[model samples]
Target chain A: MARTIIPFGPQHPVLPEPLHLKLVCEDEIVKEAIPALGYVHRGLEKLAEIRDFNQMIQVVERVCGICSMLHSQCYCQGIEEMMGVEIPERAKYLRTVWSELHRMHSHLLWLGLFADAFGFESLFMQFWRIRERIMDLNEATAGSRVIVSVNVVGGVRQDLTPEQCSWILTEVAQAGKEIKAIQSTMLSDYTVCKRTKGVAALTKEQAYELGAAGPTLRASGVAQDMRQLKYAAFDKIDFEPVVEYDGDCYARGVVRFREALQSIDIIRAAISGMPQGDISVPVKGNPEGEIITRVEQPRGECMYYMKGNGTKFLERVRIRTPTFANVPPLIAFMPGLELADVPVAVLSIDPCISCTER
Target chain B: MIENMKEITLDAVVGEASKMKSDGQRLVALSCTQLDADNFDIIYTFDKELVLTNFRVTVPKGSDCPSISGIYFAALLVENEIQDQFGIMFNGLVLDFGRTLYLDEEITTIPMCNNTKAMTVKK
Candidate 1:
């Protein structure tokens, strides 16, 4: 039997990541997928050698604009731990509030794109419309929509006022209700289920061994989430990893959909239990030695490895993004998939090539 | 700092990774940092029950570290990226990108290594 090698994309209709997959196929079914990345490689990690450590905070935020807050939060947390800076309690809650907002918007953005990937234009618009309200909240409260630059080494740079917090609560409550209205359409509709259910199914063992993270791992029933590490005000809130036993594309969709609504509750908790204190503290010295910090980003567990030499410049800053960790799992299950199913399956990982190549 | 990190020689990578696998650890991330012009510290992070166990292997520049892809299978992509970035090669890589994972054939400067310019295509 002869095998045909087909190029999937360096350009796709949807997905923020530009991935090129050389799909080896026997007729319509794929046998292996060899990925070619670096189309979006920015070498942001190497900036650590030149840029000052504090300046790198801004640099890391640009790694992935959608989850920029989580990126900076993870990086700053590692530096804070190294410098022994205990942030203010209010700062912790503020950070958690913004992180969940970013998570909700990120998940909604992904859901819209996922729907559009399969030609559900109407559903796409609905998800994005709901997402706009979250964006409005971010811009109104934090002064920006996409890359909310609220995180600093000691604490956050911005604080939510009483009226702003009240507005946010109202907005998110409405957003959660809107998400509930479309829950059946996104999850159980004939069109969505036909394309996603049982497509590119990955078992629990494969997902774990291949190093899947975030919802990709959770959708497979691993029950693992980096938020369990209790960074920020997550310790003060009640949370659980959303698990789906099917481990298919639809399960991945449900996890993100439910997480968007869950993000609403998390934001509510953070706002309600938030203490009154300073938003930031004074930092004394440079971070010395190496430390690794992990955070639950919209995609998955984002790890930051920072090494300081008692200087403004860090020796190295290695970022192992969720998409980077999730790629192997995506490739693991790609071999047995239909060529037509490749796009939906790849989008399922919520591939962020910039984060991966950075 | 690095907790639960056992220092090992380069050749012991596969053996240590195999042991971690048998213990039911998930291969999380492999971070490679240049110590100097001479060596790189390879940190293998594994998670079991949400607890991280790490193994550090210090390999001299241009040395061949045994590939853990055979054991973890997830080590393939990171191994290739390390191969491209630091100019360190992995023995028995499941899919060796031959230092072209991110770099083109024309630009040869090792990007992650110090004192060498990370070459980009003239666009």
Candidate 2:
């Protein structure tokens, strides 16, 4: 068997972001994969050192365009912990609404990209069409479609009125129904099943050992989610982490599809029980300690480690994104998979290279 | 929560990490913070049922820190990243990228370290 090496993207049609994998193959089967990052690295973590803690939220929000709100929320929570400020009840509920909305858009975006990877052009269009509702909702409420900078140190920057909340609930419910209809085809279709089922399967043990997180870990039956940590009104919300035991690409898809539905339910509940008061609390002084905060991003668990020195500028900000943790599992499962199945398996983890390289 | 952070020696990191792994603590993240001109703090965070436990180790610049990737394979990428950004050395990395994980070789100075001339200029 003659071995050949192929480079799979810093740019690829299937990958919406930049990630390079050097695949060594014997015939049609891949033997190994070496990943190269830094293609999209912008040194955001280093920038954190120069920016003031209050101003750094804006910088952190740009880490990943898909998970921007979650990043800012996580960083703000870390700073709040250091400052010891209690956020308003209304702010917590607002954060919940926007975060769940962020999750819905992110999962929908991923579903469309995943469909595109498998050459299902119509399915891709269907997913993106439904996702537009979320984008419109974001624009109407937060004043931006992509990087909704609604999070501040003590709370969120924006508030949603009762009418706006009701409108969002109606729109989300409509999108949920459509997603449910799409899930039947996305999960049970003959081509999707044949291409994904039993391909790039990771056992529960391997998933934990390789540090897989979020739906990637849940799909392997780990039952771990950062939302369970009860940050930002998650404690008051009623929801369960979606778990699938197959640990295959199909199971990963099923997990995200179900999670999108779960996000809708969570948003509905948060809105129904919306608290009253100000959306933000006044803050004073600089953060002067170190704290680690974790938030459940659409891809998985994103951890932020912030170290402050009693000054406006943070001494260090280390962002450990879900894709960084999930990349090893991608590399681990790449071998023993057919070259054609590589794209399907790679996209299953929902790789966000911008988040990874940040 | 601050009391939960346990400081360990560099030599004890591998053993302590393996013990935690065997006890079912998933490695949440590993972070390196520049402490001073020559000292760095390496923090390893683990989670069990959403409760976090942290282990900290402080090393001098250019010191050889043991790689916990042998026990927890997921540490490889973060370890390589620390090597590149902070210019620290790990003795037993599972997959050593040789300081090319996130930076090019042509860049001679570490970008994230506190003592880097670029960081000093920014300050």
Candidate 3:
């Protein structure tokens, strides 16, 4: 068995993010892996010191375009903690609605990419076409397709009008019905199951030991979702954290698909129950203290640490994204997997290198 | 319960730590900043539940804070990041701490520290 060293990315056909993994393969089986990060580090934490607290919201939103709303939400909560401000009821519901919408689109986009990676082109097209509804909702409400800077300290920047809310709910419900149909086909289809099930497997114990969070951890039978913390309006909504026990690519795919349904349910609840109140409150004084805020992004737990020295600019801002936590589990799962399955295996963790490196 | 969630500080956390391990609290993040020409502030976050306690310690010019890599493995890359961005060192990282971002062959000072000459390094 001659070992062949293959570089997976920094430029590869499958990855939508910049991550370099040196995969050592003995014939078709992976022997070992070494990951190289910092390729896309823009010194975001350093930049936060120079940017004012408000402007940094936009900066943090760019950490990863897919999870942009979550980043802004976490950042806003961190700043609010330091400043000791309470967001209005309406703002909380709006943030929850938008956050769930972002989750729906992100999971759909990943589903399409996963389908394309495994050469299921029709499924990929179907998911992305369905994703357009959520993207339109984002642009109409938040003013951007990718980096929706709706979150601000003490609340959100935009308010959802009644007409917009009604339209969004109708559109989202239709998208949800379509997603259920696609998911049923994906689950029952023999080719999709044969390609994914029992492949790139991580056992439940391994997942916990590696600190794998989000869907990867949930797929491995650990029902621990930071969403259980119920930040924003999740407590008021009816939803369950999707879980699967197999801990393979198929299980991960199932978890993500089911989670999208839960997101749809959350969006519907937020739309119907949204209260009328202020969207934002004026933040006063410098944040002289420290605050740690954690939110459940589309991928997993995204943590933020903020320290303010009573200044307009933050003294320091640190982000611990889900991709960072999931990388250890990814490295652990690489051994003994076939070379051809590497792309889907890596994608199974939903690597967002921008969020990881930032 | 609400008050317990608020007002998390060192004195309160130190009291809590006696019940936990010496470093039982999870290390959230480490940050280093240049206060003036030769002053530095290194802050570490220890969190349990929603409460976060911050430890801020200062070091003079050309000095570095003690590394907590022994306690938290994730601190390794963060130390490297702090070293690259602020020229601070964590004494026993046992890895290529700064090579991830800055690619200097043997330079010791942080590339982004105040009053430092620019290296062609991209951090």
Candidate 4:
């Protein structure tokens, strides 16, 4: 037998973002995968020197189109902690509503992409069909379908009116019902199960030590979620992480499918308990000192490390996106897999090259 | 300042990292901050049961920092990224990209380090 090297991507039809992996194979089985990034590296972290703490919120949001809101939320959370600004109750619940909506859309987008990876085009369209409703709610409330750009330093910039809140609840409930309708096809379809079950299986120990995050880690039964940190109105809402023991691609898909519905419930709870008042407060001074804030993104835990020097411009900002932490786990499980099955495994962790390269 | 942090020298990084790994703490992240032209501060963050423990090490710009990849395999990516950005060297990387992980070979400036006039290319 002879060994051959295959370049997986910097561009692949299945990949929504560019993540290049050099797959080394002996016959049909992959022996190793060497990953290469930097295709879309924008040096966003280095912009902290020029951009003021307030302006950097916009910069951080561009880290990933899908997980943009969570990125800014994490950034603002750290800035708030450093400045000792406690946001109002309404602001917290408002943040929670948008956050869960973002989470729902992000997971749905991944679900569609994951389905497409396995040649389930109909299933892919079905998931995306349910996802558009969530996007429409974003547009109606936050003025953007994708970026949203609603998080400010002290709190969120947008607030849902009573009518708008009721409408959003109706929309999410409808979307949840639609997603639930397809649960059997996405989960129990023989072809879907055949393509994913037991593929790229990472054990509980392997997932944690390799630094897997979010649904990827939870799918391995670790049950560690940044939402458990009680940021935003999560303190007021009830939540539990979705976990699956198999750690396979199928289990990962099931976790996201369930999480999208979970987001709907979280939104309902936040909106029902959402108090009236201001959505944002005025900031007086620049952030000084260091702080770390972690939030659960659709992909996983997104952590931002902020170092400020009593000036508007931050001294340093380090963003540890979920994809960056999950890459090693992707590599850890790549070996001993058939090269044909690479796409399903890669998409399982929901690789966000924009987040990773940022 | 990190809440659960202890200051350690560059030499003690590997030992401390081993203890974290033995204690079953996940490596949350390894962050590098440039204090000045001459010194860089590296913070290793580990998480267990939702709580974080951090180890801080301050090393000179030109020093060769030890790689903890042997103890915690996931540190390889973090160390490689630091090497490319700050022009620091990790002596024992499991997979050394040699400053080419995120940047092309032709791009010469260290993009993250403002104090450096040029990237120190070394083995």
Candidate 5:
């Protein structure tokens, strides 16, 4: 048997972002895959040195458009810990509400992209249609659809009043019902299950050893979610990580589908138990020490390590994105998969190249 | 939480990493911060049972730091990345891109280092 190398994409119909995979194949079976990134490497960490801490919030938020809110939230959390400022109670509740809404929209976006990857056009359209409602809510509340710059150092910039909260709750509930109606088809449809089930499977031990995070780790039955750290109002709210034991593509899909619905429930809970107070507090000085803040993003566990030097600028800002940790596992799973199944396995982890290269 | 961080020597990093691996701790992240022109601090974070333990090691410029990728294979990406962006040398990476993981050969200056010239802003 002879091995032939095939380049899988900096541009492909299935991938919305740039990720090049060099696949060594014997006929249609892949023997190895070597990934080449940096196509969209903007060097945001280096830029953090030039920009002050306040401006770096906007830069970090641009790390990934899909999970921009979480990126800023994680940065703000790190800064708040270093500055030693307690945000208002109302701010915590608002953060929780927006975080869940971000999760819902992100999962829906991934689901739509995953459907498109598998050639299920109608499913793609349906998922994106439901996702638009969340986007509209974001625009209405946060003033932006994708990169909502709502998170500030002390607290969030915007607040939702009672009328707006009611509207959001209604919208999320309707989205939940619609998602449930399509859940069986997305999970159990003959084409979807056949393409996804038992593909790119990783055991619990493998997932932990390989440093897999987020839904990818959850689908492998690891039950490790950074939300358990309870950074925001998660400690006050009732929550359990969504986990699936199978560790296959289908299991990952099931986890995200369930998580979207869970986000809806969480938003409702947080809004009903809303606290009355101010949304932000005044910050006096610069962050002087170092801290590591972890947030569970739509993809997985995103870690931010910030070291400050008692100035307006941070000495260092290192972001360990979920996609960066998830890439190695994707490489490990690729060697044993068929050439045709490569796209399915690749999309299973929901690779965000921008996040990986940022 | 600061008490949980254990500062270790560069020579002891490999041994300590192996112990954490045996204890079923996941490697949360690895970060490098430039201390000055001649020194850098490399921090390795690990998690188990929702508790974090950080191990720190300080190394001089151009020193060959022992790679923990052998114990935690996922360290390969971050190690390769640090090698590319910070010009830090890790002795034993499973997959060494030879400092081409994120940057090209034509770009010689390490972008993340303290002394590198700032990237020009296009007006």
Candidate 6:
């Protein structure tokens, strides 16, 4: 037996983050892999102990730039459950709209990153160009491109007027048309098919037993989305979980692509069905109970367990991030792939390092 | 989808809790806090999703709560954390543990609690 070691990141040019992967290869085939984290541990969880409950929403948003809105929403929902406060219908719709927008942008960002990973610079640029439209909508709606600090404990701080809501709906519709074209190109593109087809395949049983969630599990043909539980006015609005079979890299890519389109549809429905009500609801009394909250983020399902003991600060905050649940399954996927395809194979799972390290 | 997931409460299993040893269960986190001057509350989350239903057990102050670390793998770490932060004690947990969230070796008692005072000394 022969072995060789290869280091792949912590400052790699291609990867956007400092995700370092040490690969043990045997003749261009990876046999074992080890992922080294803690590069961006900014003590987000530890900061929760000091930051006020209202301020921790912003702190948790900083946990991951790509999925900031969902992070804040999850944190806020947990606090809301502890306080037993119900948000207004209009605020719920606004949250659903922004959440869908964030999902679209995040999936498109991941799609571009995956394209660039396979050295398809042209496809990458195309996907990113469309992503710019969604970013513009985010900035116009929430006053920030990435970290949209609209979520509070009970409701959203930002309210969408009729004009702003219409403008977002029109722009999102146009973006949806552009995404359809991009999807057609992606599905038929020969290079993408050749590189990703049948690579890093995981069986349905393996996906479920390892606790993989969101698109990864959806790609394996499991319709297990937390949103299906009708969270955040989703029961009022109409939407469906996008799923695909095959459970390969191509299948994961297609699932995300289709989800990006579905998010646009969900946003359109939310904006069109935007009801009339107050945006922010005041929370009273100290939180003094234990509640479990789950939300479907772009990556997968994120759960927060919060316990409050009738104080301004919480007694304990436990986060089960999607990446942490996905890591074990990702490690299980790396054993039987060629060395050259490792990066794309890992990217197929959409590893959010900050979420995992948090 | 698996519907009607079975649930077991912590209050019912308080006395005869040794039945956990026959199962491959482990502790995920043990959190504690002083809710008021009269009583303190401690919570233990177990990794029961695989073998049993994952449940959180709450123990109030002055009660001889049973320690489940002997049957669980990571219960000792969580026990040490609760002891370090809330000044609570587990009868036989391995102590003198390294700090996971705090820097000072001698610091104990919940830092986030309203009762704990901030110490400031001139360098």
Query: How do all models score by TM-score?
Result: 0.97, 0.98, 0.86, 0.99, 0.97, 0.80
1 versus 5: better DockQ goes to: 1
Candidate 1, clashing residue pairs?
none
Instruction: List candidate 3 segments past 4 Å from native.
Output: B1-80, B87-98, B101-112, B116-123
The top-ranked prediction according to DockQ is 4
The residue-by-residue lDDT of candidate 3 on B8-119, one tens digit each, is 3333433443433354454545556677778776666555443556656667766645655544554566667776777655566644434445334455445456557433
lDDT of 1 by residue, A1-358 (tens): 7999998888867755688999999989899999999898888899998899889999999999989999999999999999999999999999999999999999999999999888899999999999999999999998998988999989999889999999999999999999999998998899999999999888998898888999999999999888889999989899988999899999999999989988998999999999998999999889899888899999999888889999999999999999998888888889888877888899999998899888
On DockQ, the stronger of 3 and 5 is 5
The global C-alpha lDDT for each of the candidates, from Candidate 1 onward, is 0.90, 0.91, 0.78, 0.91, 0.91, 0.73
Give the docking tier of candidate 2: medium
For residue B118, give model 4's deviation from the true position in Å.
4.5
| Per-residue lDDT over A130-158 for candidate 5, one digit per residue giving the tens place of the 0 to 100 score | 99999999999999998888899999899
Candidate 3 global lDDT = 0.78
Q: Of 1 and 2, which scores higher on DockQ?
A: 1
- TM-score head-to-head 3 vs 5, winner: 5
In Å, residue A143's CA in model 4 sits off its true spot by 0.4
Clashes of each: 0, 0, 1, 0, 1, 0
Candidate 1 versus truth, CA RMSD in Å, comes to 2.3
- TM-score for chain A, candidates 1 onward in order: 0.98, 0.99, 0.98, 0.99, 0.99, 0.98
* Cα lDDT tens digits for candidate 2, A205-288: 999989999999999999988998899898898778999999999899999999999999899889988888998999999999
> Could you give candidate 5's fraction of true interface contacts?
0.70
Q: Best by TM-score, which number?
A: 4
lDDT of candidate 4 over A132-201, digit per residue (tens):
9999999999999999999998888888889999999999999999998999999999999999999999
DockQ by candidate, in order: 0.80, 0.68, 0.20, 0.82, 0.64, 0.09
Candidate 6 runs further than 4 Å off: B1-53, B57-123
lDDT of 2: 0.91
